[model samples]
Target: MSDFAIGLCGIGAMFVLMILRMPVGMAMLAVGYFGTVILNGTRSANALLLTETFSSASNYSLTVIPLFVLMGNIASAAGFSSRLYEAAFAWVGWLRGGLASASIVGCAAFSAVSGSSVATAVTIGRVALPEMKRFGYSDALSTGAVAAGGTLGFLIPPSTGFVIYAILTEESIGQLFMAGILPGLLLTAFFMGAIAFVTLRNPGAGPRGEFVPFEERFKALLRAMPLLLVIVVSIGGIYLGIFTPVEAAGVGAGMVALMAGISGNMNREQAVKAVSDTVRTTAMLYLIIIGASVLNPFLALTELPATLGETMTAAGFGPYGLLFLIVLAYLALGMFMDGLAMLVVTIPIFFPIVTAAGFDPIWFGVIAVIVIEMGMITPPVGLNVFVVKSVAEDVSMGTIFRGVLPFWFAMAACLLVIVVFPQIALLIPQAMFR
Candidate 1:
């Protein structure tokens, strides 16, 4: 069989393994390894595997993953995440659908630290869901809000999505992080607007929160300052060029660890648990990266990306048409695939096509992350929805799915705005890097 045909078969086998409950990393690795052995010799495949594994594991930039993850794990263990939610609630919970809106704001804030959608959803959802429930908010609206809001974790600074995208495309992590800031804030606002629209349509779905006194609100903000400061310093330092992404992550992690120790909010056991979790999460991410590293060269050997790019160009689609197709494909894949897995798998195929069409790579990263965020809340396989369901066990999956629909539209709207005015994603990065 032709090498391109073998590559297609390899992809199909990877999906089959994934369907059979094999881990995504292992699936990619197995497929890539065997595919390479078929196209090259066993010696070459073994060498590729060993070299990529070490290189990916030892990648200096990737240290940012573990450090930022440790920062988030420490924040959660120390109750800093809860404080962030409280601050958001105190300020915004008095509005219509205020609790839900606060959840969105909290997700955005924690996302700067956590960088994982699942972590953001769990941290904020655990805090916000119960309060929304107590306030007599509809389960659909409450659960949906948290699930959809959690997607911000993938778009905000310190985003794992951007980090992986940077590694895959060889783009600057700092530039991508800066590109995400404005788009992330824009999406957060759009989510809040969604909550308003929902509450307006069904007053009972989200009752107005009792007014918080200004003093109390200020105090809540003060309590949340530790995390806010970490976020500002780490993410802000990147924009100011005072720290590379790696240094920013280290500083953020150290600051959080110091605060946790001094504040006595994280006990020894909690600290240990935080470290363990960070290691586990980091390992999983590293494995995925290694798998991608192996698979990318195999794909290149098969000439799949080049062939796909040529086919796309020959199809006579304009730049926007190609982009629209890519977006639609992402949306469809989002229904069934994990966001990160989808990112790793599709980027090799899509990135070349996107860049070749004269689209800005940084802007496309923002757009890609946003679409992946949409998938987090998309039904059937909505990973964020499942995370929310785990938190709100009393709420049905269908109700949560229903809840995310409005926010899903909000996401689509955000995507549209960014596409029309690419500057929304590019402006901050351009200004900072210029």
Candidate 2:
């Protein structure tokens, strides 16, 4: 068979493995290794696997993954995340659908520290959902907000998605992080607007929460200051050139650890649990990165990415038209695939097409992340939806999916606005790096 045909078969096999409930990292690794063996003998395949494994494991920039994960895990175990959610609730809980809106706000704030959609959803949803239910909010609206808001973890600064994209595309992590800020905030606003629309259409769905006195709100905000401060120093220091992303992550992790220790909120047991969780999560990410590293060369050898690029360019759809189609394709894939797996698999194929069409790489990173974020809440395989379901065990999957539907449109609108005004994704990075 032709090399391109082999590549197509390898991809089909990867999907088949995923359907059989195999881990994404292992599926990619297995496909890449065997595909290479088919094309170039066992020696080259073994060498490729070993070299890529070491290269990915030793990548200096990737240290940020473990450090950031530690920071978030420590914060969660220490109750800092709950404090952050409390502050958001105190400030926004009085509005119509206020509890739900507060959940979005909390998700955005926690996302700055966590950088994982599942983490964000679990951290905020655990606290927000019970309160929303107590206040007579519908499960769909309550669950939907948390799931949608959790996606901000992939878009905000310290995002794992941007970090992986940067590694994959050789783009600057700081620049991509900067690019994400405005778009992340923009999507958060759109999500809130979605809540308002839902609550307006059916007042019974979301009731207004109690008015938190100004003094109490101030106190709640004060309690949340530790995390807010860490977020600013870590993410803000990067933009101001005071720290590289790696240094920022290390510093942030140290600060959170100190706070947790001093406050006595993280006991020895909790500390061990936090570190164990960090290691586990970091290992999984490393495996996926290693798998991608192996798969990329195999795909390159196949010349499939190049062939597809040529075919698409020859189709006469200008850059914008091609972009529209790519977005649609991502949306379709999002329905059934894991977001990170989709990202790793598709970037090798699509990045060249996007950059070749004259789109800025950093801007495109932001755009790709937003589309992937949308997938986190998309149906069937909506990862965030599943995370929310795990938290709200009594709530049906259908109810959660129904809840996330409006937010899905909110995501679409956010994507549209960024597409039309590329500046939304580019402005910060340009201003900072200029």
TM-score of 1: 0.99
lDDT of each: 0.94, 0.94
TM-score between model 2 and native: 0.99
Q: How do the residues 1-434 of candidate 2 rate in per-residue lDDT, one tens digit apiece?
A: 99999999999999999999998999999999999999999999999999999999999999999999999999999999999989999999999999999999999999999989899999999999999999999999999999999999999989999999999999899999989899999999999999999999999899999999999999999999989999999999999999999999999999999999899998999999999999999999998999899999999999999999999999999999889989998999999998899999999999999999999999889889999999999888999999999999999999999999999999999999998999998988888989
**Which 10 residues in a row give candidate 1 its minimum summed lDDT?**
18-27
Writing each residue's lDDT as its tens digit, candidate 1 over 288-395 gives 899899999999999999999999889999899999999999999999999989999999999999999999999999999999999999978999999999999998
Pairs clashing in candidate 2? none
Off by over 4 Å in 2: none
